[model samples]
Target: MNEVAILCVDDETVILESLQEQISRHFGEQFMYEAAESAEEALEIIEELNQEGVKIVVIVSDWLMPGMRGDELLVKVHQQFGDITTIMLTGQADEKAIERAKREANLYCCIHKPWRKEELLKIITTALESV
Candidate 1:
């Protein structure tokens, strides 16, 4: 079977760790979980994984970051890798950013910060099903 990955990008290390842990716990060993501290790092990871023949099926990203914003990253990803599913996880994102992501990136869903584990898992499950 082809290897698949799930990438979580956030500027906060704690958030990234929490997301990776929660997703791994819920999904077991079904997917390779990756965490990046910035959009640039996330893009690097995505490219490296693709080089290794691992398809990244989902990306969950925080909106406000130092460099490229999550929505911008998602839109770039959508342009380069149209098949990957993108989700926004943000506490401070405005409606316009979310709408832009939805319109341009085909965002799978937008989950607010302090998201319930169940909701995150459900959205991920749905995204995987769609993939």
Candidate 2:
């Protein structure tokens, strides 16, 4: 079977590392976890992974990225890959952006930064189950 992937996008290396560690610890080897430092890089990774026949089930992204914001990235992802689930993890995302994502991106959830590990895991687990 092609491995399913969970991609995390954040400019902060520490946040991405923490997310990868926590996700891997909870989900183990059932799915592959990937991270990107920028929205552009994440999009490239997604395209490459799709071309290689890997299924990306979920994306966790930061809202205030340097280039493309999280909502914009999620909207793009939804446009290209409608079935993939998206979660926004951000400290600075405005209400407008969140609402836009929810409407346009079919965003699964929006998590605030400094999120509890349990809450994050629960959201991902629930999303995966639904998927």
TM-score of every model versus the real structure: 0.97, 0.98
* Regions of model 1 farther than 4 Å from truth: none
* Residue pairs with backbone atoms closer than 3 Å in model 1 (clashes): none
Model 1 lDDT tens row, 1-131: 44999999999999999999999999988989999999999999999998999999999999999989999999999999999999999999999999999999999999999999999999999999989
TM-score of 1: 0.97
Q: Tell me the deviation in Å of residue 32 in model 2.
A: 1.0
